[model samples]
Target: MTVLYGIKNCDTIKKAKAWLDNAKIDYTFHDYRVEGIDADMVAEFFAQLDWQNVVNKRGTTFRALSDDTKASLSAETALPLLVEQPAMIKRPILVHQGQYHLGFKPDQYAKIFASA
Candidate 1:
């Protein structure tokens, strides 16, 4: 099964959901805000994607972080932070057939689905 992880209100998540619906792809939406994310889950993401790819540096949550926290970010440091504040994760992480894709783009989805 395909699972999409993100916050509900994010514009990118909204667009990703719409794209999935329009493509008629069957998927499960896992809202981090509502469903909550765990350390193990965050670790799984890190295993598939690099910390930079998974973390949303552009978001307000990240911007609000202390300079020390930002400068000291490593997988170990960021993992706990990501678990504590799931909104800092990049939106719409798609997991399908044990493969992971971070963020979204129509062409990218098309390619992924086609190759699948």
Candidate 2:
């Protein structure tokens, strides 16, 4: 089964949800804002994904962070920060077949989940 994890109001998350609906692919939505995220899940994503790719450094959330918070971060420091600030994460993390996808694009979705 596919599980989508993100904030409900995020545009990318909305788009991904809509695309999944349009495609008639069944998925469970896990709103991080309401449900909350833990360090282990954050670290799990980090384990499989490059920090530069998975972290939304350009986002307002990251931009608003203190210089020390951003500067002092490495994998060890970043994981807990991600747990504290879910918005720091890139949206619409899709999980299926024991794999994780950090974000969504229509074409990429089409190619990746074509058989589903």
Candidate 3:
């Protein structure tokens, strides 16, 4: 089963969901805001993706963080932060067949599914 993780109101997540629906791909949307995220799940993402790739540095959530929090960010520090504040993570993280893809683009999704 394919699992898509992100916040519901994010524009990127909206676009990704639309793309998946249009393509008729079956996937379960894991809305971090509504469903919440856990440390183990965040760790799983960290195992497959770099902290830099998973963290959304440009988002408001990250910007609003304390300077100490931003400066001290590391795998250990980020795990709890991500679990507590899912908005700090990037949107539309797709996990399929044990493979993980961060972010989304039509062509990228197409290639990923084709390769799968």
Candidate 4:
């Protein structure tokens, strides 16, 4: 099954959801902000995806961290942080056919779902 992970109220998540709906693509949205995230799930993502891409460095949540914490960020440190603070993760992580896609854009979504 395809899964989309992110905060439910985020604008980028909204756009991604809309695009999926318009394309008639079925997806299960895992709202990390409210429902919480699983460490194992994030760990799986880390194994296959870049830690830098999974951790949203540009978000206010990440920027608000202590410089030391930011500096210490790695797959090890970021995993627990991500599980504890879902907002620190980039928006709309689309997972399909066991592949992870980070962020959102119309063209990106189009290509990601082209095989769906």
Q: What is the TM-score of each candidate against the true structure?
A: 0.96, 0.93, 0.95, 0.93
lDDT against the true structure, each candidate: 0.93, 0.87, 0.91, 0.87
Residue lDDT tens for model 3, 4-105: 999888999999999889888999999987888899999999999987889999998899999998998999999999999899898889998889999999
Candidate 3's error at 101, in angstroms? 0.1
Candidates 3 and 4 compared by TM-score, better number:
3
Candidate 3: where are CA atoms >4 Å away?
Answer: none
| Cα lDDT of model 4 by residue, 6-116, tens digit | 898899999999999999998899998667788898898787677788898888989899999988888999999999888988887888998988889999988987777
Model 1 scores a C-alpha lDDT of 0.93
**Cα lDDT of model 2 by residue, 73-108, tens digit:** 788888887888899889878888777888899998
Looking at model 4, residue 78 earns an lDDT score of: 95
Model 2 CA deviation exceeding 4 Å by range: none
Which candidate ranks first by lDDT, i.e. highest?
1
State the TM-score for model 1. Answer: 0.96
lDDT of 4 at 44: 80
| Candidate 3 global TM-score | 0.95
lDDT of 2: 0.87
- lDDT score for candidate 4 against the true structure: 0.87
Clash count in backbone of candidate 2: 0
